[model samples]
Target: MISARERLLNYAILIVFSAAALFPMIGVVAQALQFPDLDAGTFRDAWREGHFGTYLRNSAIVTAVTVACASVLSIMAGYALGVLRLPGSEALFLLFLAGLTVPTEAVVIPLYFDLRTLGLDNTYAGVILPQVAQSVAFGTYWMRAYFRGVPRSLIDAARIDGASSWTTLWRVLVPMGRPAILTMVVLTSMWTWNEFLLPLVILNSDEGLRTAPLGLSFFQGSHQTDYALLTAGALIIAAPVVLLYVFLQRRFIAGMLSGAVKE
Candidate 1:
């Protein structure tokens, strides 16, 4: 349907954009490799000096818990709001939408104090809970849209087969919504992993509980002049999310495109 000239032009644009995006990443990797001895063990040195093992473990714990809780809550809430059409559902959906509008900066101070009062400060729960709430806000919105777009006839057929609502959701819809669910998981993981402010504020006095981004900030402060170490540390913090996206790129893209074409 398209002319060869237009297709070539599109390819040219894509290549240019891709190169532009990758250029800085390539530069960082190259700079990280710039060691005096050319084998100075920059990444190893950075890892040991930065104490990234603790930070990364903390981050993994927080991200995994947040994503799991948020995904489950979001799916249930979204299904209720999008499919069940319960009384007052629209109002409740708006409440969830309101959560999305509130910036973390606006409440981080009060939240810290409240968590401190509850003895949750400086703990994994402190970091994980707020992030779960934040992710659920967005996740509910995303999954609601996806569920709303699911064919009504398909749902009706499931119901006719003596499937309970819970069974229908788990067996029929969730499997069919794999791409959408995975897309949500990937996004929530990235956001929780890279979160800096929440962990910084909540775990201020607890070095052992620092997340990757918070740890990287301190690493940068101490190694200000050491570009190679800094770059290596940056890469180390970023690698997990990068690998995750690369692994899920196809599903992620498919989910995004599906949303585009659906309601």
Candidate 2:
């Protein structure tokens, strides 16, 4: 059992980190709302001037496709490695794990050229494909760990009941694994939505193909001296991710903590 003192210390640490994380956001909100005359209609003007509608559409398309593809691929790969224990699975798992160690910057130059050769550069596909690959690497590791923790008896019982591996996974395991799956989705969504570097490198030539973070950068450059507009644009770009976490906080926390205790 955790001691009272330990619990208190943990809470204190969390509180400190939470405040540290939130302080800048609070400052941005304050700046966004300040100097009524100068700041008046700043967000609206920035939105229109930056052509955020186009950027948002591009971001939505990239993030949605990336997350959807990554989630499905990760789930399937996780099942194979974690449950089926496919031949050479450990080597395959390690190969996927290698992706986590490779920094994006190291590969972006080669990736840019590859996408250009494929005629995908300056296109949403160029940004979406790389981010999807990154998300799947992490997602497969996460889901595999969660799946491996399932009871052997449960899996055996599913097999005894004449269920195919696909049915057993989708019906038996996936239902029980909702928390883990939802957590992965929420995380992947956040990463995809906030992605900047890939979009910057791949879609530099196309303003209409820019994602939210990329658009915000250009917005900042244009409004270099306008703190209010800059802050407002930042908030606008971040609001979707914030709202996603707000709605899924419970499942996200539960999924993160579920592995802490074992039966």
Candidate 3:
């Protein structure tokens, strides 16, 4: 157990880091609120002029589709790798794990050409598909570890009850794995929403298809000197991710702690 002195020291460190992170955000918020007649009109003007409404919609669609597809694929792949007895499953799992090591920048240039060859460039499909692939890679790794850590007795009991693999996974393991799964979804959503490079390369021409981060970059370029509009636009783009983290904080923390304990 931690002593009172250790706890106090830990809190002190956290406070220091928390203030470091919040200081910039406080400045940005203050700038947003203080400029342009010292009111909230900056946000409205930034919203209208920056055309973030369309960008937000595109980002929402891409993120939703990518997360949903990646989660389903991850769960299935993880289940197969973690529990099922198949030939060369270990090698297959390692292949998925290898994807986690490959940096996005290394393949992004080639990916652009490949997508262009497939005539998917400048389209929502182009952006969403690549991000979905990236998300699935990490998601598979995450879910596989969680499923592999499940007790053998629990799985055996489910099988003894004459449950099929599908039923066992959905009815038994899935319910028990809610925290892990929710954590994975939240992480994937955050990654997908914040993704900029894939969208930037794939969506060169279609402004309507730009994700929030990409749109924010373009907005910044046009409003180079306008800090208020820039900060407000950033806040608008970042709000969804912040709200998501806030709402899922408990589940995310539980999942992370459980994973750490298991490790």
Backbone N/Cα/C clashes per model: 0, 0, 0
TM-score of each: 0.91, 0.95, 0.91
Q: List model 2 lDDT by residue over 174-217, tens digit each.
A: 99998999999998998899888888899979888899999999
Q: Comparing candidate 1 with candidate 2, which one achieves the higher TM-score?
A: 2
Q: What is the lDDT of residue 76 in candidate 2?
A: 94
Which residue pairs in candidate 2 have backbone atoms (N, alpha carbon, C) closer than 3 angstroms, thus clashing? none
Which residue pairs show collisions in model 3?
Answer: none
100-204 in candidate 3: lDDT tens per residue?
Answer: 889989999999999999999998889888888888888888888888899889999999999999999999999999999999999999999999888888899
Regarding lDDT, does 1 or 3 come out ahead? 1
Model 1 collision count: 0
Find the candidate with the highest TM-score and give its number: 2
User: How does each model score on lDDT?
Assistant: 0.92, 0.88, 0.89
Provide the clash count, candidate 2: 0
Candidate 1 structure quality by residue, lDDT tens digits, 1-263: 99999999999998999999789778877776675642448889989999999999999999999999999999999999999999999999999999999999999999999999999999999999999999999988998999999999999999999999999899999999998999999999999998999999999898999999999999999999888789888899989999999999999999877655356
The lDDT ranking, best first, is 1, 3, 2
Candidate 3 Cα outliers beyond 4 Å, as residue runs = 2-24, 33-38, 261-263
